[model samples]
Target: MSARISNNLRSAKAVAAALSDSEDERLSENSNDGSVFLVSNDEDSEIEKVKGEDVITEYEDDDEFDLETEPASKQRRLNKGADRQSCRGSRSSGNPNFSTNTKNDDMDVETPVEAFRVLFDDAILDKIIIHTNEEIERVMCLLISKEHQCQSIHKKIDKEELCAYLGLCFYSAYFKENESCVKDMWDDVFGRGIYRATLSGKRFEFLNRVLRFDDKNTRSERRATDKLAPIREIWDIFIQNCTNNFEPANNCTIDEQHKPEIIMSYNCYKGATDTFGEKSHEFSTARRTARWPLRFFYNMLDQSAVNARVAYNLNADNPRLSRKKFLKKLAFGLVEPHLRRRLGIATIRASIKKIIRKLLEIDEHVPAVVSVIKENTRSKCHLCDSNAVGRTRMKCPNCLRRMCDDHRTAICVECSAAN
Candidate 1:
């Protein structure tokens, strides 16, 4: 009985398959002919039979189509579906495309020196909150520009050349800008992330090089004036603002793990139990002569100590020397070998002597003004050293120096004479 039923069903399936093909051809012919389409009962009966056979056929295939035994085409389709779904989710969630490279085509080629000037013009520069941004960009531009000119003569710019350009550029412009704002942004520019290419592994190693420019301030300037504290304070503010406030949507996540301290202690004092001391080399002398500002010296030493300790912990085989020895070593390392390699120590020393002489002259000239101004300006004008100072009066139309009500022609007597 079952054999008879199976034979009958197979014959019915064959008849249904033939009718399905006939119907498909008729539908296509009618579609092209644009005639009145008709679904007769005979065609409907044939369609129902075909659909029943298709269901049976799908069941048979599903039984044979074990996922483990599925063909590569099926697997590929499955994977493609999953990938599409994941991409949809990523797009919906605002996933950052971190893989996009930051370097532009112009960055690799001969970058125009004016590229920096364009980047730092008032429109872009005014948006920067960090104080060091403008100065750093300026110096970077100057160094790169100067090096570009030098390299044009030779036809190349290498990594060392780039670094030396940075060093010279930064050092040259260090004292020319407003010191207060410069000091405030010290950490963000020099202490953290990758500014130019300084390594933070050495504690305040980079910052110490930076603060060298400001070390010449007279004793009075060293005191906390109304303006701002020394360079270290500037760095602290930068670090605080950057870590706590700035919203970095793209870069690496910086957290407490990275900033282990408010400021790293460069030199440690073994003898003292004080919170700030850890017996560093600069401690004794700095305390004795009071040559450097105590706060600035402490900050420098602390940063150095922190870096030295980190280096020691990392087992970095960097040359370890006493405080005085390290300065000499760093100074020696600072001299550019490509340009001055042939120069002898005597020539270098002579250059150093000239720099020292110039520095001393500045020191003498600055103090003379300070003393004279102190005597006369008890509350007097900085230019004329006269008590001719007042508020709510027009400035000297010529000199623009503020003058007393009596002097509001405010023809600064000094400017009047100059004309």
Candidate 2:
């Protein structure tokens, strides 16, 4: 029995020796691969320490791992200080020149209308008229039936009508009535009478429907590279005008509350923007529309009004001049040039002519002859059939343009004497 127990013990010792050899071989292989296994007397404690050190080393080696030993609050303070230093350095070395660069002279802004023209002048109006007429032509071409091409559609939009349309737009914004329906605003009883007086509801709707800043035919090609292709041309003109007329102060801030500067040079002018926001909200011309380009156009109109007011106030220096009054004058001024041209039209109603003369402050005067035309020579009447009328002997003495008897105005001696 003693001999059998010794044999079993020998077999157990051989198995234990085999396991120890395998463990040593694995450790030796690990060491060969540049792995260091520390030897310590306290095996369990040393194993735990090595495991902890391995985890720390892996974390440190990771590219994305941030080694922030400091508290979060302390770290944030350090970052803020660094940002402030950079901002201060940039601002100190930047451009120092800042002054008003008004393109208009004092004499040019003698009247409210004149002052308003400093920004939205005749050139802008001409461009709008051209584009509006082009849009009308496009719509006309699209109409398949004669019934679809109404008389209004056949008649091209002129500068006078465009001015009236813009005047109504401005009026709507000024009264904060843009939210109101067009029919409601034009209502005889509850509605403001100014809208109806300025333009017929249908005409106003038609103009609004066709109003465009750019040609639609070329927009696709332009839009490939320019996202703002729709309003780019007019927007460029407006930007250029603003740049020429106004200049920012030395300490101008873009967005103060959200984007603060390191060293705020001017705090007093800070409230100027806030004040403008509040006032512009009160007189905002923005109308909700699905078309982004149309919405952008509305914003442009609103900005134009505000800029005109600024230009007027700067030049006029009239403390008593209210925005409401200035806008009224500005609208009239826009319509004035067109109204003057309409005065020469023979088909215009007597009542309308009288109103135009009154608005223009024109005194009745006798027509004089500058020169006599050759008896044999005949010219078409300026007011008749788009210059297709039968030649006439009559001509305007002021402009020396040919006209018919119906186109001539006859004034009483007393009226002419008064002038």
After TM-score superposition, the amount by which residue 69's alpha carbon in candidate 2 deviates from its true location, in angstroms, is 29
Runs in model 1 lying further than 4 Å from the true structure:
1-233, 237-278, 281-306, 309-313, 316-328, 335-419
Error of model 2, residue 156, in angstroms: 1.5
Tens digit of per-residue lDDT, candidate 2, span 128-173: 7788789888778777445564564346877667776777777787
Each candidate structure's TM-score, on Cα atoms with residue i matched to residue i, is 0.20, 0.55
TM-score of predicted structure 1: 0.20
Name the candidate that leads on TM-score. 2
State model 1's lDDT.
0.32
Measured by C-alpha RMSD in angstroms, how accurate is candidate 1? 28.3
lDDT of 2: 0.62
